[model samples]
Target: MELALVLPIFAIVLFALVEFTLLFYARADVVEASRIGARLATMPGITQQNVEAEVKKILPPQLGQGAVIKTEMGKHSGDVVMVAVSIPMTLASPNLLWPVGYNLKGQNLYSETRMIKE
Candidate 1:
């Protein structure tokens, strides 16, 4: 009887742990992608489209599918180039749990980086 009572709770906790771990990993990937994009943006003769492509390549397929990338070019020395990436993340369905009314759907993660022109 006790096993039945605690089983659902244990399952939900396990699901939450895994989901949160994946979420944090995804966030880190986004941060790294933005930094790389910004660094590439700082180089001479690198176009905005190239920066966007590099950022997309760094991200996983899921995140890259709906990623929004913004790049700003720096024309003069010491000017700052900016790269911003926005990725909308979809959490596991509440149905996967015991239906405790938790809605983590449609969470968006954003990262921005700026670097001076060389």
Candidate 2:
């Protein structure tokens, strides 16, 4: 009886751990994508739309859909260029025993990077 009671709890913990790990990995990818976008934004004559498009191309398809990219550029050369990326991810897997979704449905992971315009 004790074994049966403990097994489900253990399995839930294990699944939760795996799900959190994947969430962190996705967050890291978003950070990298933002950095890539910021680097592109530093290029001369690059539009905000172009930078966002390039960032989307670098991200995985699932992440690309919910991804939002924002860019800010200063008026002068050597000015700061900032790029931010946000991705919404669902932490709870339907296959898991407990569907403990975050913030009702999912959480948004955000990343921002800045560089000087060249």
Residue range with the least summed lDDT across 10 consecutive positions in model 2: 91-100
Candidate 1's TM-score reads: 0.87
Per-prediction CA RMSD (Å): 2.4, 2.6
Query: Per-residue CA lDDT of candidate 1, range 1-118, in tens?
Result: 9999999889889988776777789899899999999999999889999999999999988789888998889998789999999887672122243376655566678899999998
Model 1 misplaced regions, further than 4 Å: 91-98
lDDT of each: 0.84, 0.80
**Cα lDDT of model 2 by residue, 21-78, tens digit:** 7777888889899999999889899888889899999888888987878889766789
Alpha-carbon deviation at 90 in model 2, angstroms: 1.8
Q: Residue 47: error of model 2 in Å?
A: 1.2
Model 1 residue 4 lDDT score: 98
- Candidate 1 achieves a global lDDT of 0.84
Per-model TM-score, in order, reads 0.87, 0.85
**Most TM-score-accurate candidate:** 1
**Shift of residue 65 alpha carbon in model 1, Å:** 0.8
